[model samples]
Target: MSILKRDQGGVPRADPLGDAAGTTALVLALNKPVYPVYVWFLAESAFQLSLLTALSMPLYLVVWYVSRIGNSRAARLGLVIVGVLDTLAIALIFGRESETLAFLFACLVLSGFAFYRCEVWLSRGLVAAIFFLFVLAESLIGGPLTPITAGDMQNLAYLNITGAAALVAFIALRFPRQERMG
Candidate 1:
């Protein structure tokens, strides 16, 4: 049903980078997605967002190491290390705040990348299925999502639920199969 296309390798061909519809592009955009909530939750919103946002900090360090070491393999290893660390940080956030919707979004991002990294390294279809599930879950349940207030958390639960449905629809269109491989 989707428009984005993929090669037999399960790789998207639209982006010269074989992005599968910019999965890497959006995945790296943590600051943009979590920013509005960061503005709303402000300082009191626990360091969850801050921690997750810092996942990209290693880019600089990896750049330095890769430049000095002159090894792509080391750079890749650095990336894997960062992904694992980010996963731990996200899991910690998820463990502490299951009720928080922002935390759920963060979990989705972290878990998605974890799956991506695993699939690329392990060469397994099951991991691809897990990645697909994360995309499907986000596409279905993630969008301009946030928990406005304590009151909203309970009485306005429908708001988040509907927002999630909208997200699913948007992603359905946004990351179509046809656009993936060109």
Candidate 2:
């Protein structure tokens, strides 16, 4: 019951993008956990991080795809395509070196698109995909930008928490009240 209207087939046409303010808030919120994970990965080895990413990403995609089966065929198909692209992007982020930051930035941009344009499940799924990709990439790419100091870690945490709070508030305002009430 968002700003969406139905098509001639009686299908609920989805929003072309998400609410601008809401998606922006969600992006900030979703990007929070990357700092700590990046820090932890830097403390560890890139090999371990990549291995972890390679293992976990496929599992997550499978789970996410399975969970979306109840949706309409078109929606499910769209989710699968996005999920596959996301998986490939994640693999590239983990597989390559010195490009984690770039990939993370790209994923975040996609996250913004997902939040604004896609359905709720797709929006949420895209965020999850971005988080894992960023974490894996951050872990592999060790450099000046990577969080090393305690202060940097703390600052990242602070930003993430603030973003999360804002995201929650915006989500509350953005979605239909009846959906939640039901």
Output the number of the TM-score-best candidate: 1
lDDT of 1 at 74: 36
Per-prediction CA RMSD (Å): 9.8, 12.1
Each model's lDDT comes to 0.37, 0.41
Residue 150 of model 1: what lDDT? Answer: 44
The per-candidate count of clashes, in order, stands at 13, 4
lDDT of 1 by residue, 1-182 (tens): 53546556553333322222233223334333553364335432333333454555545354335524444333333333454344344434332222224323432332233222223544244335445544444344332123334433332244334443444444344433432222
RMSD of 1: 9.8
Deviating ranges (above 4 Å) for candidate 1: 1-20, 27-45, 57-88, 94-96, 99-124, 127-170, 178-182
Candidate 1 C-alpha error for residue 101, in Å: 10
Compared with the true structure, what per-residue lDDT tens digits does model 2 show for residues 1-182? 54557556433444222223223323333443453365354433332333333343443344334434433333333433443454345334333333333334433443434332324565566668767755765566444322234554344334434543554455445544432212
Please report, as a residue range, the 10-residue window in candidate 2 with the lowest summed lDDT.
15-24
TM-score of each: 0.35, 0.32
